[model samples]
Target: MQTLYLSRLQHYLFCPRQFALIELECAWEENVYTAEGQVMHGKVNSGGHDTRGNIKSVRTLPLGHKSLALEGVADVVEYRTDEHGVQIPYPIEYKRGKPKSHRADEVQLCAQALCLEDMHNCKVTEGALFYGKTRRRHAVTFDEELRALTLEAINDCRYIIESGITPKPIYSTSKCRNCSLKEVCHPKIFNKNAKAWLSNQITANLNEVRQVNNNDD
Candidate 1:
């Protein structure tokens, strides 16, 4: 019954090993991309308030769903009055990059919406992702497909965290291209025969050192 961090849904979608390393093993590193994202989220998490007509923007709202065992802070939850004049939560997540070819971000946002719906006892039809690169918000409808994917991700994350088993890393052009854990995860080596490769490399380096010593003698 380990509770899953709502934010880690995207990380799990990107790579389960990355998720396990961060959540389970407590391993983390900061690259340029991660740093930028951290800064953005930090700013968002500082807490702010903005009001526009029927919309009230609230930053850093703590959300949790007991049934799903999901807990995290939403970057911004806009309380907007709908046509029915009822204020409903609309979550907006901040990211450092542009929209990717995958639905990881969408799934994360949808998960937030699900949390909001459960917490508020209302229906959330959509949320959004504000990409720094685009400098705009992209709306995401919480369709059935996206909801299913989000739920699946939650279950998968729970399984990984409960088992405390880190999955093997696989090199991905998109997922691992700018991953901060690339060096620690060692996808290229571990995906193949890492033990054998390391052994050969160590032996070769030793032989070269021995040859150099012999020449010196």
Candidate 2:
């Protein structure tokens, strides 16, 4: 099995074809949204540490789990003493946009929690996602459902990526508006042209069959 990036799980959840396009086809084009996200990540990726009382924040911490075969860096891992005075790890992800209609962001954060759980051999029950647009931390619970979904996403990503095939793009103005690869993917144009070409081929084949039948008669 190929090692998958934990980050790609969110992309796969968002759109499997988008995940394949980038991970398998090595295609990417940055739009304003993606650019902003990169900028936010850059600040955290530099690596830093801060302490306040019993809570500590570590930036850009490396995380991976051999069982899941996924690897990536968590944007932030906040540590705090629990009721029993034991330090607990809480993974937090930073996003450029607000909460979407999907659970991609939450799945990504949960994947980080899973990694932390694997590395530390402790249960990670929750995490947080901080959105720059909202300037609020959205807490995510690593419940059974979310963990199952994250595992499903990881498996799907590995299957799609290892096959080395990019799936067809489904165009939606609203969805594609913020996609950086919209121009390269050309979802609308590509599907339109494909349909046109298929129609032409069928027409020509019918004509050829008719001519053959007439000649035989």
Candidate 3:
């Protein structure tokens, strides 16, 4: 089993094709969104630790889980004492933008929790997502639904990596317009042309049937 990057789960949720292109085909192009994200994470990834009262923050913490076959560095992990006075791990993921319409961020955070649980041998019940745009933190719980979604995402990524097939580009002005790989993907041309070719083939098949009827007559 190949070790899947914990970050790729977010990519998979955002767009499976994008994940395939980057992971399988080794294709990458930095657009404004990606560049900004990298810069945003740079601050958090600088590697440091801070203590505030009962909470302690650690940065750029390496994380992995053998069972899940996932590995990556967590942006931050806040350790706090629970009611039992036992220290608990809470992962904090930094994002460049605000909350998205998709569960990509949540899934990634949950995977981090899974890794933390495996590493610490303690249940990481919740975590936080800090968005640069909002400058706010959103708490995420490791519920059954999110865990299942994360697991599904892991399987989806593994399947795509093993299959080594790039998905056909989907043209969406809202989505592809800002995509960094739009030029390489060429969704505008490929999707439109593929649809046109399929239409033409159907038309030609119908025309041939009509011509055969006329010849019989």
User: Can you rank all candidates by TM-score, best first?
Assistant: 1, 3, 2
lDDT values for all models? 0.91, 0.86, 0.91
Clashing pairs in 3: none
List model 2 lDDT by residue over 103-187, tens digit each.
9998899889988989988899989999998999988999999999888888777778767778777777787777887877888
Model 1 misses residue 170 by how many Å?
0.7
For model 2, how big is the CA root-mean-square deviation?
5.3
Q: Write the per-residue lDDT of candidate 3 for residues 1-217, one digit (tens) a residue.
A: 8999989898888788889989998889998899999999997898989999889999999999998799999999999987888899999999997999889999999999999999899998999999998999999999999999999999989888888888777777877888898888888666767778889889999999999999999
Model 3 global lDDT (CA atoms, 0 to 1): 0.91
What total of clashing residue pairs does each candidate reach? 0, 0, 0
Candidate that scores best on TM-score? 1
Model 3 bad stretches (over 4 Å): 193-217
Q: Per-residue CA lDDT of candidate 1, range 1-217, in tens?
A: 6788888999998788999999999999999998899899987888888999999999999899989988899999999998999999999999988998888899889999999999999999988999999999999999999999999999999889888899988888776878999889988878877789889899999999999999999
